[model samples]
Target chain A: MNAPILWIAVPFLVGGGILFLLRERYAAWLGGGTAALLALIALVIPIDTALLLGPVSLKIAPSIQILGRSFELNTADGPLLAIIYGLAALWLFGTEASGTANRFVSLGLMIVALLTASIAVEPFLYAALLLEMAAMLVVPMLVPPDQKAGRGVVRFLIYQTFAMPFILFSGWMLAGVEASPGDLGTTIQAGVMLSLGFAFLFAIFPLYNWVPLLMEEASPYATGFLLWALPTFTTIFALDFLDRYTWLRTTPQLTNAIRFAGVFMVASGGIFASLQRHIGRILGYAAITEAGLLLLIIGLGSSEIINLTFLILIPRGLELVVWALAIAIIKGRIQSLRFADVQGLARSYPVAVSSLILAHLAMSGFPLLAGFPSRFALWQQIAEGSLALSFWVFLGMFGLLIAAIRTLAVFVMAKEDAKWEWNESWVQTIMLGLGVIGLFILGLFPQALQPFLSNLAPLFEHLGQ
Target chain B: MVTDTVSWIAVGLALITSTAILISRDWRVSLGALAVQYLAAFWLVTRHLPLAMGSVKLIAGWMVIATLGMTRLSLMNLEQQEEDAFFPRGQWFRIALMGIVVLVAAGSAPRIEAAIPGLGLPIIAGSLLLIGGGVAHLGITSDLLRVILGLLTMLAGFEILYAAVESAILVTGLLAAVNLGLGILGSYLLIAGSSPLENEDEL
Candidate 1:
């Protein structure tokens, strides 16, 4: 395997191996710090492949054999891997300060490894196993002992598992087609299964309870990571599927369904989050909404949509950082996240509160934040003589905006019973300040990142077409 | 047609057993029902052994669930045992209902004209059984462990189905790591006691 791949796996292996070897404090810091460095290194490395075992080489474009099937990575995979691993590393950093940091780092890296394999492993069956594994890997992060294992963790596991058959069956259908000569019958079977499989895996619509259920019991930090990374990786993986089978992209009805699902998820998530009392669950719902929006972009089948997804993803990372840090600072002492509890909080911790507001605005797709540009372009595309889609997209955006507004009301406008005080460290202030600046920079100078998004565009474009 | 006949029978039996466990009023009967379902799964894998190393995995997962269930049953104090929970009829009905829905849904999917080589009807039915089990798990069990079992069953179902396609050794090896993580997580949850039951709505 390539050094970069090793870089990702090392922390997980070492973390798990030494989880009980060292003192808890040192183990967590070591694991988290290692993961962070690995991520930084991954971002700098040019995507390359190397031999690991025989013909099963790790390369930018090399064949991989999984479950008796062959798969290869094209040049496009480099950026996807970089983004997935890079974000994962950053999420690991938050783990350093939390209770399950060791397990989180271990599982986080393993997930990254599995996701990478999902991209490179062929025959769809390999990807199926990898995806299932990713879901299982999260069990450690989500279900820690001492907390009664509520129905949420199991629900999440069941939902993901139930979705697995669709992928497996679809892979079988695809393989059968490959074996036979021009079998349209098998292709259609594969197509239907593919759609259903993805729907289940992504937790679209009715199967979506696992998110809220799991969040009900899990750490906000872990939930935040799960919300952002799992769905984002799955979205990218789904794009890979469309890229592999060009005809899927041409089917406007399918695209329309994806768009519709996206709109529904965002709208529903927004409404749900607005009513939620817990801050963590609010973030989870927002992520679901964000995921729905990305799907809509994919359904649009434009290269620019891929660019839009990337832009959306990067800034969302900042939200996780801000939320995780804030939660850690608060230490779960606050009773409720209702606007009422958050009242007078800002007076005490202006920097943290301001960071929270900016993050919320960015997440809401408000103007002058990182989310604004992408949301603007995406909405513009939706509104182009397609009022039905435009309406749904607009509604989805509006739902998120409402959720953000509600959060703002709770923290900014609600009255408090106690006098406010500020006591967070300077390091936290610096982090939040940088996060706000990052959002502004991205929003004000979208052109600066245009080249980066454009360079990565062809990878998706080629596969999609 | 031969493969289909075997698969349908296997799937049918598995589904029935799954529903039995789901609807069973007694915890002991539910455990018994689960055992039968798992045995059927093992049988399903044997029917397509060349394609399915999944049976070994299925057995391993079932063993874990069975041990945990036994432990919980043994550990439950008399007063707790007398309590209505860990065996709620309402929840059991939900499990049965979900199982039925899964069965109908899986059965209703358009069938493949021919079974792929090395992947016969038994494996297909076995896979469906696993999915149904998952549905039952999520629906019937409110306890964390039971739900985890449901999820495990669901993954087992996915694995059996996956066997009918490409047999990627590396993927299987990688999935082992995932399974290990599941084990670790389950242990952790058992260690982490539950919070005071809350009626609070999740965000």
Candidate 2:
């Protein structure tokens, strides 16, 4: 059996089967179960290597060819697969609780498989096409059959479409650069094109208006899942670019430019996040800030920082799940996610609001939370380089801190006679409880998930400092 | 020599069709213009690819139009069709944008052709027109259907440019799939968005 076929093709087909055959009640279970099983296989099995069990010998080959194109997975990619599918499992399991079980689970599976293919496809340019497919797939999930397509949804599709051709063009140019290594003009153009491509793909800085807009329009849970799933893969993919080309990582100008982009996104995203009134929009900016942190960490451009990135990244999934789920639970009861509408929600739904605030604070990098340790480590590293950049990054985090404070005040400003109560469904309470616990565990013991992501560095050939 | 004339004609048709799609107040005209635009796309793509290969874009584009047309045809009754204006509101503004785009395309095509090498001026010029027109279409429209058409128009332009540089069969097929996918997505969104209105109209 080929590894790519097992990991990519099987799940994609299975997701289709589930979507056609199953009801919503079973979709989440079946989808989450499939994701969990895939994660376990990725964890236990090594690609391109033979495994013997009982009297049988079996090997899962690394690559599969379909229509003259190849999908290849090396041994180092196994852990990455494990981590991705595992994180996806977390999101899938939360769907039942978050009330987006139907399309969220089935399409989530297919989207995950497509993203996996984006990594595994050879010549890698094809990855852009696959990513485009995945982004389009996100639309059906974001806009339910009952809801009208909003500007955010259309904008998301358009921006993603706009990004594909640039990346594709840059990929062709990069091929030219590889052939004539001395062509300075071609190399420079390729880098610029690649940067522009990612600027749209990552929704960096000003291009990120759609994030908050989508947050306002779509289900917070769906938006949160989209935010988690896309950036997680995109960050890995961006880091892949660094790993593949010495010029991308080694050139001081490129690296510095990248670092500046990361800092600027963080600073700008934070300022906007703090100023937002709607909690959904606040979550949107917070996710953008998280994306910026991932970019900043990648700009740090060492294998160790990549390792640190996993620490930042794993907790991010938990934070978003908790935050988005909390919002979903509260939004079910209320009309809007605006601060004024949700004021005093803590009195009515303390568990939901508390989890939301905790997730917000974690994202703010408050000490002793899952979002803190890695960010603190990143802070120390950035301060070593430039205190000025460090200060700005800190200010971004500070803005998140302020937003969390504002959100907290709004949640607690109930009438004096109002009493705290648990309004969450048992399922929501359990899911949110587990998510909050996961945050605390990671915050206290930040290195625990390292085993899943430990070998990710070896997946890249030259990215190690 | 005849083929060269045909290619230039195709380029002109592309620019004209794209402009029509942009300025047309009626969705059917926009769709009809999209159909014609695909023929232009086919001709320009034949600059690098064979006729059979070039037809892939045409086929994919027509398929997109078919999907969108069928959806809109069904849902057209749901929306109250406003009387056709000689130029819709902001129609003059859109026309002005197209004028700028045409000049910009004329100005930039030679430099792009020089930089890329081997791509002719017509291919470069038509692509820029399509891109600029598509962007202008996207910018002026708030309607979901129009936004999608804008995307399709823009993608057609990009497919033509990319066909010149990388003529791999797989790239051709993938681009075709992207076109088809966009069509289906747009159809789905249009139908989904209009259903509530359909329900209301029935009421």
Which candidate number maximizes DockQ? 2
> Could you give candidate 1's per-residue lDDT for residues B1-203 as a string of tens digits?
77667657767767766666555555566556666666666556555455356555555656655655655564455325424567644665666576576756567443631534456656765676667666656765666555555665666566656644545565555554555455555545654553333432111
TM-score, every prediction: 0.83, 0.96
For residues A1-465, what per-residue lDDT tens digits would candidate 1 score against the true structure?
A: 444235434555665675445555565456556655655554554455453557675543335443466656554455555556556655665554444445566667667666666666655455666777777777766765445555667667666666666776675566565576377767777778888888877788866887877666777677777777677768777876776665667767778888778878878887787777666667777778888888878877774667777877777776666666565455454665545566656666677667776777777888888888888888777787488877766676676677667666666653456556666666566656766787788778878666456667766656433
- For model 2, the superposed segments whose C-alpha errors exceed 4 Å read B78-87, B197-203
- Native contacts retained by candidate 2: 0.56
The TM-score that candidate 1 achieves is 0.83
- How does each model score on lDDT? 0.64, 0.87
DockQ of candidate 2 (2 decimals): 0.51
Model 1: lDDT equals: 0.64
Q: Write the residue-wise lDDT of candidate 2 on B107-203 in tens digits.
A: 9999988888889888998888898889899988767778888999898898889999887777788888888999999998987755654443111
True contacts kept of each: 0.69, 0.56
